[model samples]
Target: MSIAVQDLEAQVLGLPPEDRARLLERLIASFEPRSKAQEAWMQLALRRQEDVRSGKAAMVPGR
Candidate 1:
């Protein structure tokens, strides 16, 4: 990795957990802003995740 990247990574690592998470999210989003279809899928995924967390859905082991 380049020195600039190493420096930036070190600086980011020194940030608080919340700041690090926020930065990570922003960095990921910067790569590709979600399209409407992607946004809908993300919403669905979040709902499904909540359902699983709430015991409304169960995980099945795959063979």
Candidate 2:
């Protein structure tokens, strides 16, 4: 990798967990269309919702 990219990677890697996650969110949004990602998420959510409703799955309480 080029020096500039290496430096950037190091800086990104140094970010705190939350900062890194937020950065990742922005990176994905930049490359992926909002509607496409939203559609995928919605599909997964609906399937999970139906699973619980149909008694095929159950929601676990978060600690």
Best by lDDT: 1
For residues 7-59, write the lDDT of model 1, one tens digit per residue.
89999999999999999999999999889999999999999999999999997
Query: Candidate 1, residue 52: CA error in Å?
Result: 0.8
| Number of the top-ranking candidate, with TM-score as the measure | 1
Worst lDDT 10-window in candidate 1: 1-10
Query: How many clashes does each candidate structure show, in the order listed?
Result: 0, 0
Global Cα lDDT for candidate 2: 0.92
Pairs clashing within candidate 1: none
**Residue pairs with backbone overlap in model 2:** none
